[model samples]
Target: MDAVEIKGPAAAFGPRHEDINEDANRFGDRYSIRFVGKDKVCTNLKYKDKHSSVSKDVSKEWCDGCPERDGCAYFEPFNQIKNKTRSLTAPHNYLEIFPDILDQWGDIEVVLIDETPWYNIFEKTARIGAHDISHTRSALRKLDDEDKADSDVIKRALSLLDTLSAGLSDKDGGERQADRAYELATSIDFDELTTELTKIHDGRVLEGTDYTDAIVAIADNLTEIKQTARWASDQGIIGEFDSPPEQLWGVDNSTKDNAKFELRWRNVDLMEIARQKPVFVLATEMPTESVEAMFDLPVVTVEDTVTPEAEIIQLNSRMAGITRLRKRNQTFDNLVEFTRSLFGSRLLVR
Candidate 1:
């Protein structure tokens, strides 16, 4: 509220849904700021009240035909981009999911980020199981026999899946090395695999089968696999830690019939975000060297101390200094007694 009242327009981002709801309730009506939520952006529930339900494709067509599609927040940040005084709030994860969202929002004089965006920037490990590979390959084989025009591409995709599945599940060949994983990853062209997967996705969606969601999920999994492989291979963070052999690709063979392959990256750079805009991080006691290690750029650090307005009281105990193993029962007794003495008979809750 203060940002919009004092400055022209400013956007704030939080990390959780409760944060968004609270901010929307507090400042949404006063400053005319909008909170972008899934319900507001998604067209799935637009016609849920009707007797006959609309398909995802039909709902999208209806949304596109609407007169307010251009300025609607459901489609894009149209009004926010055009109106300089229009400010909006959203979760921090939107930036990670949609890389071009910040650019679409146009220029803002100020961007107030609530918490640390570093945790959101770290990519998670992508896993592909034997079952997924086998199922997708079987589906592609059937697709290959049916679609004669695209049979060659479909066969190539199946071959890549077969190669990956065999390489990961070679029981007699010992554990697959990180270098071999990189070889498997780079052996097939990512763009070619993507094109084939897209064809499968479109066909499955049009067919409206039970496996449409599964097909989309596998496509996303493959894309992530390609991404993780490329990032892990190119970063060359292998051998940078104590255990270098299993850093890139680690296989979990706990389930006898199914083998799960994981692609991991130990260290990654933040240059992509660092170069976008000047960031002011609020890490209370982080070292300058630690900050510089993640972002390979010149950093300026400022140190300050915050003094609490309220007086604080400290209670010392000699028993606290003793290890828990030395006096297990005594430590519990002492804690109970301390709690009893601190707020004597006032129905205290800790």
Candidate 2:
């Protein structure tokens, strides 16, 4: 005997192109009851497809004796099948199934299914999709509220972003390097600096000192050196550290001289110099090795009772020490002269 493969009734089949419009409209109305004011409705009801005829024929037979025929315009079998599928797939919609009760609540949550035949019933019932802009707007509003509630967190986030923006604005190597150095100097923890500096110097461990204090102390001295360099540069005494002439002092002499000069100066030269000068030389109590490493130059500790002239002499001795290190090394003549002028006769010791 041949095996008979009996297919179920055609009514059990999925919705065809002909049933799309009426189905979409019915779904839109149902969806609007729960989401109308809070969300929008959309459907792929293009004229390129014909779904009306098939929907009407199916609606006549399925809804023939149904009491709820007036309220529903969907094909009866399709509607029944879709309703059952939507109920299973979207419990949230099912939870608020009774439209009268949901309407009274004023704020109902509706979740629409995918674009498949099963989900189409839900769409016909509650027209929503994953890409709805209304849903996106609602989610963003919730996030904005949370961020607004935390002012300190927001400020920190903004500060970090500002720092990043400033860094990205400059593409020049010198500017980027200088910015990085500045960031490192300002943001480094003093305690960490102390620990690292201590390890480098093999010095007696200092007590009661933290990273900030150490970093601040070193940063103060660097600020002075930087200021001195700027003052010398402004006086046409020092050239850029990495440029030709390798001068410790002298104004920039590029083709666009004044323009280059202005670009190099502006507010930074004065502000940084002023801010950094006072702390140029750390206190006398600092370990000699650590001080030397911090400045990348020799350091001399003098008693508080030392005179200004004696301090100058001490600086001269330090410069002499640096000169010894530069013996036989190529010296940019202009830079050497500039440095000598800025630091006075002491810078020429060698």
Candidate 3:
């Protein structure tokens, strides 16, 4: 881990994991937080991609208008994170921030998962409706009229919208039609469009005006579709979109005029991406069988010897799944009373 000194809000933990401190990363007597630099602290993808070498302005741009800025105590006027920090304090959703973690970190030596990483890895689905595209086109026109957004960028985006409208036309098989749309989606100059739209969004957010909403909506939709295409292509199952066949993509034709397109990827080999590093998951409750099923890997359980003072109870009853417990109020009330009688005011029903 690159060890660098960081100051101000740029060094603070993100909102969800702010409770964490240097103590949480203590390995024996050594603290790992000292290695976590600015790139890891900032969730901005643009900054993380370049590591510490990325411009400080990237972090400033995000923090300047961040909704979470007001709640953080370490807020600083400038970002102090440096590139290639040796250690990182990442959240449960670090995969979202560092999708290419293995590439950047080069085969993780060890990972102490605070909880189960049993969630879906790379599988995702994104959709947008025809009307949403229509609204985006109109919004872009409005922005152009007001000189609030770049006319060239707006024009290109509007043209892409037209391409999507044409691509979505029902003229062939579902797979062929979807492929046509996906091709159009992937052909976008994503970096250029995203950067321009993000600038507009940052400015618009400050003004409390959602003039960029429709444009943002379409951009988000296309980004998702592009991601789905990449993952599907990587797995060599791009054309197999049918659920029974491969579950990669789908078209929602329920609405005649406002049809939606959904794209999905079933699974990704988490270990393959991690370079087969040993993953030690810590959890209060985790199903080994579930983990094995999703990851296709063997799991060994290690139970703590220290026992809790609280009495443990397990109920094997279908009554909890009953459709309407209200109809059997007496039965439910009796169970509650029995528990309350045993525990007094300490009983908590959740």
TM-score versus the correct structure, for each prediction? 0.52, 0.16, 0.37
Tens digits of lDDT, candidate 3, 65-151: 766656433332112123333344544433333335434554234444454433343344445557656645655676678776667
Q: Give the winner by lDDT.
A: 1
Q: Candidate 1: worst 10 consecutive residues by lDDT? A: 341-350
Q: What is the C-alpha lDDT of each candidate?
A: 0.47, 0.29, 0.45
Q: What is the alpha-carbon lDDT for the whole of candidate 3?
A: 0.45
lDDT of 1: 0.47
Off by over 4 Å in 3: 1-91, 98-109, 112-119, 123-135, 143-180, 186-195, 209-277, 281-350
Residues 102-197, model 1: lDDT tens digits: 455555434444454333333344456666566566666665666632665565556556655665667743254434444544444444445555
- Per TM-score, the best of the predicted structures is 1
Comparing 1 and 2 on lDDT, the stronger one: 1
